[model samples]
Target: MRFSVNKSEKYTVLVPEEEKLDSLKAPQLKAEIVTMFQSGTENLIIDLSSVKYVDSSGLSSILVANRLSTEVNGKLVLAGLNEHVMKLIKISKLESVLELHPTVQEAIEAIFLHEIEKDIEGEED
Candidate 1:
């Protein structure tokens, strides 16, 4: 998979435009996801605006990314999912595990808002 990262004061955005079509190196993709997490970004927003089709292996990679992000108390939000990709996520039952936003702006706001809510919850506790 290829990605470009942009960091604002609030969060880091990873825009993954293309993914490996084959199932090989799925583990490697997972490793890369972990690397992105360790890249010192707090909240993460993954823009899937350019992604076309995501297979089972790709879904696995995304799950790993989500897990890594949550481990570090960060948000992993997906934006601009195409119809086919959305179907794949729905069929895989991954929609429940991941957050979906219609636009990049919405995803960014949701991620930051989620973090703020988490912080508030932590403070309350």
Candidate 2:
């Protein structure tokens, strides 16, 4: 459950320090994601560079974050996933459901692009 959070006006980056993301840590991560959304953080990037492993619960937590972001018309981007983690997500057929980025910077850029698209769509209305 140990993580670091860096917040900006546009989005927040959450980096879990744990090497393994399992049932024991998933709930805490879920809670943190919920808290951030409740506090008006719409866009989020989860940097998983340090995490080498993930279980079903961990994937569930990530799904919850994606659901919350979708509910608010925001974006949830997962970044820095290692090969093992990426393989698991692909195996689960979640690679299409989740936004994956190779780097946090790329994820941040994506969030910005999403915001721009939203802005454009709003202007059309």
Candidate 3:
């Protein structure tokens, strides 16, 4: 899949430039996410603004990302999902599990907020 990775202080934003996230590109995406996690990236935000379609394989890849992030006490968030993608996630009953935001900025903010909360809890501990 054609994509770009932007790294910031506490999170990484992956923007896929493909129109459809299908079996052909999902494996590559999943591999990349694994690599990022292994490299110490924890918080992840996937920007789906350019994606119009996502198949079951794509959803599986996303779930993999979420699992990887959670394994490290981080977060995986999705943003800018179009109607079709949103419908697919809802139909799959993943809406309650996956974090969704209307924009990348919102997702980033949420990530930072959660991080701060975690830090506060750690201090208490």
Question: What ranges in model 1 sit over 4 Å off?
Answer: 19-29
Candidate 2 stretches with Cα past 4 Å from truth are none
Estimate, for each residue in 51-74, the C-alpha lDDT of model 2 and write its tens digit.
999999999999999999999999
Q: For residues 1-125, could you state the per-residue lDDT of candidate 3 as single tens digits?
A: 68999999899999999999999999999999999999999999999999999999999999999999999999999999999999999999999999999999999999999899999999999
User: How high is each candidate's TM-score?
Assistant: 0.86, 0.99, 0.98
Higher-TM-score candidate among 1 and 3?
3
Global CA lDDT of candidate 1, please?
Answer: 0.79
TM-score of 2: 0.99
**What TM-score does candidate 3 reach?**
0.98
Off by over 4 Å in 3: none
- Total colliding residue pairs, candidate 3: 0
- Name the 10 consecutive residues with the lowest summed lDDT in model 2: 63-72
lDDT of 3: 0.97
